[model samples]
Target: MNCEFVIKEEGHLTQSENGPEVMYKEIKTEGDDDIKSETFPAGDPLAFEDTKLEMDQREEQEDGIYIPIQCSQTGENDFTCESLNDVSNKSFTRKPSDYTHSNEKPYKCSVCNKSFTQKGSLKMHLYLHSNERPFRCPFCIKSFIQKSHLNEHLRLHNNERPFKCSFCNKSYTTKSYFNIHFRLHSNEKPYKCFVCSKSFTQKSHLNEHLRLHNNERPFRCSVCSKSFTQKSHLNEHLRLHSNEKPFKCSACNKSFTTKSYLNIHFRLHSKDKPYKCSISSKSFTKKSHLNLHLRSHNNEKPFKCSVCN
Candidate 1:
């Protein structure tokens, strides 16, 4: 006559045939009064179908493997179905412009006040403050902050220059160096001096140029107290102080402080005259000799007679 349907803790319904018998006992507790009793027919097709569908959904969710779904907006494959569901429930997903407007930085560095949207980026930024360099080069004593940087430095020891330029076919050890070299072929000067408005291909060249404008000679010779805008100039100046002739000519046993001086000395050994006078068509080993010969064509008297004055 009367049928009472009780929902168990396992979320399953106990069934019985004929006269619609009460298969499950409703447990009476302090909070159990909220559990309303419902009456249904013994052969209710709709009730059984709805229960079966709910059980099927619960089984699918329990047995389902976590499938990652790519974020269509960001073009990143990192976003997963579980993350999407979590984000959707919280309604935290925003457009790129909204991030800039809101200035939302969820991740913050413990060491510094710097904040980032991504946790992985914040972890990477932490390396800058610490002196912990675990990734070391096998060939050299130099250690790097990142494994990728160490891998790039290893190529210098191995002489493995795989990245090549499309225009000049010039090869570089690293992709970053290769991309920088490619800019030379493209004549792309992205870095520009703020004072002079002069452009440079490399950021380092721009920084060196900025030193000239600032009159900042950071590199100084220890022996002479002579300052230089560049470190290479200071290094060359050091050789003069120490009388160190590191660049040696293979033909002769004579050594020079600089490689350019050694190259000039090499011409005396092999009669290789590279500098030529355009007017006379006469070649000379040294550029000074070629310039002296060109003075005859132009009648340029660079040397003035002080005795006559």
Candidate 2:
């Protein structure tokens, strides 16, 4: 949210930013009323440690409430939306950080007793307790708690990928997914691991990498009892027991358990040899095959028979 527009009801205004955190301003309207306007960095899908800010733990200066409102559409991509004052007849008295500051959680969940700063935010959080999915997809039997989620689900059914990468031959249904993918081309690693000081483009990738350092394998196979750091890896491991090859090739009737294998299978049909031997000018479909071919050039017999060795 880029809040640069002037408010109709004016007073004095103050603003500041902490690191790569949100850029926000405090508008002190008449009668000492506080109206907050916040703008986070555009195309940044992270909401972890970098965004964490401990609010000033001071006395309540004003006796007013706050309601978050934007000039237009609000979603995962907040940087795109321009924040205007009094849009949808809404007023702000406190920033989101103030909830942690004053310990003032006005909205409380009836089911779980969980507290929240905003009413709308609390209403969305209640969906978890009630198991209520209001947003339903007409094409499929899937339902979602938020409308934005349902919109993204609908795109899958429609085969619509609106966000196309200018740098690569890739597209994404959601802006957040696109932003994460775009980071790979830009070589921007925002999420850093505190333990190893290693970084990753997305926060989820950093979380997965942290599991390696912690020796945490949460996703366990029911059949084999083998554990994996990621659910996708567990799903792929399960295919060995089930022999379920879901990903199918369009050109041929060949199927694979994983999408990566299916993508490699497509190269066979297209004759797309991305992996090449620099010495011989020979190409191969897989990097493993090219590595094996490279071994022949150096006469490196790494794989020795047990009896012979």
Badly placed stretches (over 4 Å) of model 1 are 1-103, 106-112, 248-309
lDDT of 1: 0.62
Give the distance in Å from residue 4's predicted Cα in candidate 1 to where it truly belongs. 36
lDDT (C-alpha) at residue 94 in model 2: 39
Q: Compute the lDDT of residue 12 as modeled in candidate 1.
A: 26
Tens-digit per-residue lDDT, 83-195, candidate 1: 23322222122222221333566668888789965444555577788877767778779997666687778888998999988777889999889978988778899999999
lDDT of 2: 0.64
Instruction: Give the lDDT of residue 70 in candidate 2.
Output: 41
